[model samples]
Target: MARTGRRPGLGGTRERILAAARSDFGKAGYEGTTIRGIAAQAKVDPALVMHYFESKDGVFRAAMQFPVDPAEFIPRLLAPGLDGLGERLVRFFVETWDSPAGSPFLGLIRSVVGNEDAAAQLREFVTREVLGRLARALELDQPQLRAALVASQLVGLAMLRYVVRVEPVASASTDELAAWLGPTLQRYLTDPRVTKVNRRSRRRR
Candidate 1:
């Protein structure tokens, strides 16, 4: 049933904006999803949509609330002295994307595949949220660059394994993938040589 003691119209404006954004973004993607379309769908003035979210990007961010926030998970993923972080990272992602909660990720992949603008937004989101945070947690000197590198590798894996469903790799068990990928991630995160050039440049100054 409907939520108790609350009319359908209660909390209507915000809910309507979110609902409109979800549909518009899912269908038309980031670039195609316009304030006018959202306002039309929400049955509210365009100004109202802007009032809730300053821009399209803002609406997109609010609409896509992943079940697990990196703010909560990243610290756990990076807890000092945690051995086998690479394995844990792989396992965490595999488990997350395999579960029902990963529907949003799947939807995001589909959106990106179909729309270049949406693909850029997806890249931005991954960079800002996942890779950026991971870099900071690892205390990388160039957090953004490191995070983008990690995101590229992980996003590629997700695309091939889950979205494309490519043959044996796609069918490969999560544990198997983790075993193969964990070491690479470990090297990326811990290898002193990963950013030797950058370190050397800083040292020279």
Candidate 2:
């Protein structure tokens, strides 16, 4: 008699799968990456990947584990109402990135800068998971556009402060950054000017 199939309690298989997934994702993006491809690279059966991670999205989330749980925080942020949301968002962003927990986010931004596929994947993920939720919660007009505007600001801030490490921005304290960016974010979130701009653009079209 012999043991057929993978050995029980084998170590490294999970890590190997994750590594393969990360590489594949970096190269192919989420839509291009496949379970079979990841399993092949990891030298494991597709079933094994499903067994450990459940699905592609699960694997992606595990591979790119964000320090904060969006489910927990998004609600909390919304709970306080829209008042001061801009400052709150800025504070949260800088504080999170300033902490050790921000490593994954930093890595993500770096990956996005060099890889178009990675950038697309990030855009999809942020829009779908983060900004989309915020926009819907606010019940604002032109939610998608509003969300995109917010994302642009935050992403730009992240690039300067963390990835590029630009002077002043990179060296600034979280409170300083929050104060500087808060009003702008607040405007993006609630200002009627956004609606006016949209109307003007529509008239031009």
Candidate 3:
């Protein structure tokens, strides 16, 4: 997988870097993952990572394999504050995936079922870039689990509507879906009752 002999086109080397970067980022999160580490994972020189991605941020962008940058967009989404973050998140998720721009994600998401590497990359990106960030922003207890719960909501919605194409749920209006889904997401992100219950449950065990 190392590009040794003559310089190969961007076709192979680039794909390799993306795959490696996704794996490391998925496992390590952003802060823990490094360019050198990704290069090593990809079986290529560090120079190649820099060459292909320019920096850690660039590598992360490519690894996410999504059209929108959740790191950038998430903060903006929460700029109005976390009061309606669940609604905001659902809107963003619905709008993006339903739009033409989100077309690629359908294929990318489908790949996750059978493609472990792709799935890892996606799982990391959503957890770190989207759900992880959301959890941290809430500043609540068990941010990791809270973020994961939120991610499950969005992912499940995507699978049901876009992938499975289930009736009623699949054809529901975004507003209707958001109204129905947003409250649960809101509770997951900010409800202290659930948090306290979960914490106590952990203690009992």
Candidate 4:
């Protein structure tokens, strides 16, 4: 009789799942991809997928080769209660990209430049995991706008410093970048001026 349980010696099952997951995520994006779909593509049991990755986010992180788990990292960044968060955020961002672990992130950014699917996936990840979470943490009005503003700053900085390799930004030390960007981030997160601007813009409409 044939065996009815999990296949023994599943040597490449994990790798297969990861490959399938990457494909699915690239095509369907974070919100559209599902564990069952990934398992189907991988030719593995859903149970096996869960056993290996535990959850969809786990699979995403593994497949993407994320350097740090945002779920944990975001909370830690928030632990200091909003004081100097901008500097801390900038410091962390520069340090992470400077390290070997940032290769995957750099690859994703490069892909986003030319690939719509890659761009969508990145937008979703940033909206849901990064911007959305930060907005929620702030517990203030116009969360979406505030988050977008903050993202704009960081994204431009990243493009200039890493992709374009432009002037002083590219050569600047992490400390300098943090010092320059931190206050801006802090303002976006906590300043009443941001809300005032939004209100004024709305009044014009």
Candidate 5:
């Protein structure tokens, strides 16, 4: 039986627009790429690009698709009754970074490395799409700080391994690194002493 609604490839103009936008965003950094360029590349109208994505940032976000949404990822990472969560979190990040899903992520990171405009764009994307959203979803206290620490851990490791390709650090297995680094992140994520004052207020609740 044939299902109703738009078929996969025949989803019409919108699919075409996204396909073009992805290529443009990947080849060109967030700033370097434009809606006009995407429309031209996709052989569509500029209006269509705007129609689908709303703006360049929207196009980039859609282009660099993530396997896991932050709403799901953060809560799972911070789930109660899960001890040694730091290691699990590190493992999750390592697996994602090493997977095929991470290619677009790496591309975005490389784009941010040198250029100021690209860096700013990347920062906004990371803070809003990746970190801030996760914090909001998880109800994590001091979301900005937690997100920053999480980013520091993941990004620092990515640089050490993939970018700089440092010695033992680069070659180290994910489990090995997790063993060493999990406690540090665990402390950041859940240490009572770190938020002693805040914890006192929560206790009053």
Candidate 6:
């Protein structure tokens, strides 16, 4: 069955597509994600993705409403090498959340009740841009899994501190918190699993 096209310039439809793009790109990253996938996620015809975004790159650029350009920052961050990547990353994240710019994140989380779209945007962005970049740089055996584990810590911290407003985890100083969390992320980025854990996990999936 043909999917009917919405009227051109339909109110809220473009926003819906953009939000869906954010979610898809965040989850799959630019290379792994697709326009047709985004269209399906948006509940629109694939033509509409091209109509609104022109191309996959266009969709990616627009979908990334990040506070900073992840591409530029990722390079700069990596240039410093892996010695203190975890600490540097955590410090940056905590600083961003503590700044006025962090307001958008809080607002997004606050508004996320029955609204997973915004959550997806946040999740995917961190997953694709931050974790993905860091993982690849490590050249670990299971880089993606490692990065994902690290992302869980960072995202969990964000949710606790900014969203759920959990007491000590929320109020603790960034350096103090980073000191505790950085090493865990470092392990995920560098740890080598001698067992078939990585291969076994793939088979299970």
**TM-scores for every predicted model:** 0.67, 0.75, 0.73, 0.85, 0.63, 0.63
Using lDDT as the measure, the top candidate is: 4
Best candidate (score: TM-score): 4
- Give lDDT: candidate 3, residue 18: 81
Candidate 3, residues 1-205: lDDT per residue as tens digits?
0122225486688888888877777677778899889888888999988886667866776665466766678788889987888888899889988876687677788778888766766776677667777777778888887888888888899999999899888999889988999999989888877666534444453
Name the runs in model 4 displaced over 4 angstroms. Answer: 1-11, 198-205
Candidate 5 Cα deviation (angstroms), residue 106: 2.8
Per-residue lDDT of model 6, residues 1-205, tens digit only: 0111333368778778888877776667566788888888889998978987677755664554344456666677678887877787788779878976565655555644555655665566667766677667777677777778877788789998887889888899988887989888777766565223635444453
Q: lDDT score, residue 161, model 6? A: 86
Instruction: Tell me the whole-model lDDT of each prediction, alpha carbons only.
Output: 0.72, 0.78, 0.78, 0.82, 0.69, 0.70
Q: lDDT score, residue 57, model 3?
A: 69
lDDT tens digits, residues 18-74, model 1? 888888876776667898999999999999878776677566666664445665678
Q: So what's the TM-score on candidate 6?
A: 0.63
By summed lDDT, the worst window of 10 consecutive residues in model 4 runs over 1-10
TM-score of 1: 0.67
Worst 10 residues of 1 by lDDT: 1-10
Assess candidate 4 and give its TM-score to the true structure: 0.85
